[model samples]
Target: MKIIVLTSWLILSVSIAFSNAYMPLKDTELESIASQFPPLEYLNPLDDGGLLQPFLIVRIPGTENSTKVQNHVNDFFIKQISQGQNSSSSEIPMWKVTHDSFQDSTPIGDNITFTNICVSRDPELAINEGDKARTRKRLTLAAHYDSKLYPEGFIGAIDSAVPCAILMYVAKVIDKALTRKQAFLNENGVGNENNQLGLQILFLDGEEAFHEWTSTDSIYGARHLAARMENEDIENVDGLIGSGLSSIDTFVLLDLLGAANPRIPSYFSETHDLYNSMRSIQKRGRNIKGLFQHKRRESNFFSSPSVSENVHFLGGTLGDDHTPFWQRGVPVLHLIPNKFPPQWHHLTDDVDHLDLRTVHDWAIIIAAFTAEYLELTNFILDQ
Candidate 1:
């Protein structure tokens, strides 16, 4: 995790917009999304083939371990999700995988290459010639895939390992729902309305600083990608000219998660309502039986709106991967805890220190949140 500082300039300078009302998923819809797959299927530490186990290593930038982890993410999206799907066939939904690789000088006086793996399932991305869907909005979910350089063997389980695995799980669960929705629309001979939002999952590299935290050293991948996307133009299908950055509805960055009894506070006032939506999702999960196996002795994972509202004026937002995007006018929902975990940046931050119950519950909460955000409830229920 990058060092957090309370900068008043950052709070006053970034753009703010009124958040729209989020439609709360019904109880049955919540249950259906939660039960679509086992919450622990990808997060289980004992399962070698699962997403979590492969990330339990020291993956510093430009290292062999980092390449291995990057390949794992690529394989899941390319081979697993987009394996048999024919691009010519609109009935089958496919994920578009792209890599943003660049090299820069580090604080250690060495230049190394870093790659950001981006996988997206845009409903309107590529269909038949006449049936091409125009990409409108995307709910971008992101997390860093690199560990700190100081610790020789730091696994960074809670630092970001578990958060990366959680994203993979979310993508896998939502892919099925998306496939069904596309198939249903195709069968009914109905086009996807302009309101349908796309899902993009980013596995960023070089989030950690080589030596100490600084403006240039930390968040290497985010700074590079944000600048690149700002200028890169997407192929216009509906005569709409927009950069990749403009298409993002919201950028949700998860960090320092997977610890037991974490208190995640809402930082920006603009996205507080979106934060409340997540809080509402977490509250609604309690109503579904067996959704949360182990209850935290402390407060819920999300701090109450009443309590978090005060944090807006305190300038308590952390300097993280979202900083670059937020500076570029992106509405960011930073989901890191107010207080860093005790095991943060320590050798004990390995897999043994992770809480299975907290890990499992977070997977469900985030999965449910994504389902509602993408409006997958109607399609998932149809399945």
Candidate 2:
């Protein structure tokens, strides 16, 4: 993704209201969720079935390695999640997978095909209710899986490989909690009225520019998918009509992470409260033993939410996959460091340079944040 400076006028003119309440997890609850799954199973490079390995290759759009990475994502949702279930049994709740594929011209003088993979875990009542599914709001986590094309054998570990792996880990850790919540709702017969929220993960393609960064060359998959969602109308309920993009409660995009001692800032004012909530979660995680392995660092990954009135004049926001959706009025939380890692866009940005402790810490913090955002603390604790 390319970094474009935000104009002061544009930043000041934007107004959005976010009204979601965040319920913080207890110390024991955070420890329970963090310990449910192996922290380094997905981020470790030595693990053969890990999520980061397939992404550690040169996976440009319309290439063989790109397809391999896409297959790896699909297999996780299908085979890994569906383990021990019979073919015809619906005992386990599965993620509904969909794809948005298209062809577009790039600066490289070729039309490349890009596909965006989306998987969701909607409530059972929403699935059975069919047309009323639009009433369910989605909390989306996204990261681009495509690598840069300029430098040969560039892996983009911190550029986005670690971000993608972190998303996968979030999905895996929250699956059981989501299932338990669904069962509780069904047992109580609350239907979709109680919790009309779901989880969606997107693995985007063609995020890197072919040559120089331009408006049309960068974020090809995001541009197409955002436009398509804008056209599709949501089913009206209570005389309220909205597009598919409006169904999103918040769009959280992760990029340029997994490096040590990185500082992330709150880019948008609308989601500043949510950013603070994440910072609180990270603080709670630091107290948990064996969670944060680094002993010397006492600072947090996120910067203080307080900022000067002239923050926008100092190039506050960035141009990335979230730009397309944010332009259409979706509440976005951009979780990239204020200053990028030392290996940004370099050929040395590989698995060897990533900090394992930082990688595992991110997996814990993000998973805990997802649980709190979805209001799954009670169900997660019951498990």
Candidate 3:
């Protein structure tokens, strides 16, 4: 009789604990994670004529200098996993580079090639009847590391440097979190293992236009890669997520970050739900100093969040790296400031003018949105 009573109490305790622990993400927590990125000094180019030396995602076939730059970016993500403090180091991801060539009527040539960089962790194969079964879904986080050209100089810190740096740290934090989770499961030997979705980071190339934004001009790398992925024979491929073009669950793109109270207006008709979900996540995090402490406040998910309705966007639409994927009907979440910063596209945009708080806020929003999408709130709580 005593054993039965104890078992019932234990089960009830476990249920209650799980329920109580699943809390929404906090700003302070995300800020700490965002701090993992190096300071502004390391984010920009050498502040000379060197921008074109390496940032020429515009030139035909790209350049070895830019490839070296791409590799330099990849090295940061790799280093965090290899030398991360207070996190498991096993199962570090590798960057998958695919050199894509496309036809371009440029002054230099017609056939232009650009290299795309991808980093992702393969999901553990499902066990079913002594054979591999379904593979877990994938969530992609993308940012264009390559910048447009300028006659004088285009460091483009706000143009893309902020987003790229934020993603670098986001990858680092998520990698550490995932490794820690795997280690936890290893030690405890408990819980359903396949309850998580895999993460894929895509740092695209050739996002900016060599000349102007045309149906065929901008997003050269994105266009080629998306078309290529769509054409691949999925049947022959093993672990192609779930579907070929449909393998990706959501492709969230970040741009024009690191400004004070930046506006993020929704554009795409399909991404309304996803955008709302993200907005709700941001709303929940900005409630108060300690709103989460009160159980009552937790219910108010989106109470008076940040907004700047007076600010206008570019034709109520945006042309960015996600255009190619969105053309294929892939769900895209475009996180760009509604009011494009004053220093946009000009030489004035640099690390000295960027706002760290806004950058930190962006990191928080992106990470929190991803965690919610993957249903990892409990994971946050568990930690």
**lDDT tens readout by residue for model 3, 62-89:** 7665667676565555553446354334
Which stretches of model 3 miss by more than 4 angstroms? 1-61, 84-107, 126-135, 183-196, 235-243, 287-316, 378-383
The root-mean-square deviation over C-alpha atoms between each candidate and the true structure, in angstroms, is 2.9, 2.7, 13.2
TM-score, per-candidate, Cα-based? 0.90, 0.91, 0.71
The model with the greater TM-score, 2 or 3, is 2
Regions of model 2 farther than 4 Å from truth: 6-19, 85-93, 126-132, 191-194, 236-239, 295-297, 305-316
Best by TM-score: 2
Please list the C-alpha lDDT of all candidates, in the order they appear. Answer: 0.78, 0.78, 0.54
lDDT of 2 by residue, 1-383 (tens): 56665564353423334334566777888888656676786678777688777788888888889889889888898778656545245453568788788899998767788888888877666334454445567788999999999788898998788999888888887777787777777567675433767778989998899888777889999999899988988863333677888767789999988888888777877777788888888876777876666543356787754552224522235788988888888888888888888888988788888988888888888899998988787877744
Output the better candidate (1/2) by lDDT: 1
Candidate with better lDDT, 2 vs 3: 2
What does the lDDT read for residue 175 in candidate 1? 79
Per-model clash counts, in order, read 0, 0, 1
Candidate 1 on 298-372: residue-level lDDT in tens?
A: 548888766877765322346799888888888888888778889989999988888888888888788888877
